[model samples]
Target: MPTLAEQLQTALRQETAVAQRLYEVMAQEQSALQRMDSASIQALAQEKSRLLAALDQQLLARQKLVPNHQVEGAVDALINTFPAAIANPLQQAVDQLRELLFRCHNQNEINGRIISASRRSVERSLSLIRGHQPDAVLYTQNGGATRMGPNRRFASA
Candidate 1:
């Protein structure tokens, strides 16, 4: 049987790999969002979900290996319990995993902004097609600004 350190190391490696893959997927997702590629976006979303689950599982495996796993900074605390030889490499691995996860988070936020902008555009288009004027600020001939009413006509028949 492998030692506790060995098992934790293995689990951390797996988690890092999964996080790296997730970051790549998020990058692809950003590209797809920019191009408005629905098909690729849908497929990438599924892959991202699977990778996320795998990451969670790996984290659980690591948690099981360490006592007091629920405590904040548990992994670092566990690493500190080991000798320098083992602890150093484990700390490096943890740092790499953190960097990957951080990149994934940033990319996901950018993608979300893209999605929100796209949704707003579509909604605006739909409102125009449905003969509804979306809320808008209009400047009058008297150099005054006024809020458009909901019942205002968008176009003439």
Candidate 2:
């Protein structure tokens, strides 16, 4: 029985909460990456996914409450048309959510890069364990395949 603006404000507040949690998780994930803690990273990733799903639900709920949800400038239109008190609080929530989500994205990107680097290092280590240097391609001078390098024998294990 709440007004549309009130519903939207509530949804936006919920969205902001999810975004804030996601941002914290991403920050913790970055720390886990630095510490090379795969278990913590996995746990944080699951939590982040849950927060994202909740945020998506909040967005859909907000969209459903707004009449001009599909319009390009619906948010701006809504803000300009609503009362100052409602509009101001909703706008602040939206702004804070935007900034928190941005931070989450940036941190997630950096964590992805760190994970990629770690994977590469692990791959190199595995390659060495298997007696194959990553850069040492087994090929002859005439483009023929030949194992003429000092590499480990994987079959000997």
Candidate 3:
């Protein structure tokens, strides 16, 4: 059987690799959003889910080995549990993984906003085509809602 330190190293490596892959996937997703490629974005989302599952599994394995399963806490646990020789490298690996995962989060947030904006734009266009103003809401004197009139702008164009 491999030593605990060795196991920790292997797990760290696996987690780091998965984190890097996730970052790459997020980057590709950003591109797909920019290009408005629905199919590519769908495929990328599925791939990201799979990678996330794998990362979860890695975290489970790390939990079995370390007291603290969280990336930041796990590094400290590894340093306290193992020798300096093993702990130093593990710390670096874990730190890098954490950084990469953080980048993935930031990129995903940006992509999400872009997707939300695109969805709103599409909904507005559809509403206009259906003879309704998406952004215009009129209320009666008593604060009752009124039915929307046909959006004549589209007809005149």
Give all candidates' CA lDDT scores: 0.89, 0.83, 0.83
Q: Which prediction has more favorable TM-score, 1 or 2? A: 1
Best-performing candidate as measured by lDDT? 1
lDDT tens string, model 3, 49-121?
Answer: 9999999999888778886556666558656777778778888887888799889889989999999999999
| lDDT for position 54 in model 3 | 99
Candidate 3 structure lDDT = 0.83
Give the candidate number with the greatest TM-score.
1
Clashes of each: 0, 1, 0
Candidate 1 residue lDDT tens string, 1-157: 9887899889889999899999999999999999999999999999999999998998888889989989889889989999999999999988998898889889889999999999999999988777676577677899998876777665668
Q: Which ranking of candidates, highest lDDT first?
A: 1, 3, 2
lDDT of 2 by residue, 1-157 (tens): 9887888888888888888888888899899999988899889889988988998998898888777789987886887788898788888877887798888889888988999999999998987787877356566579887553665354573
Task: Tell me how far the alpha carbon of residue 46 in candidate 3 is from the true structure, in angstroms, after superposition.
Answer: 1.4
lDDT of 2: 0.83
lDDT of 2 at 29: 89
In order of appearance, the predictions have TM-scores of 0.87, 0.79, 0.81
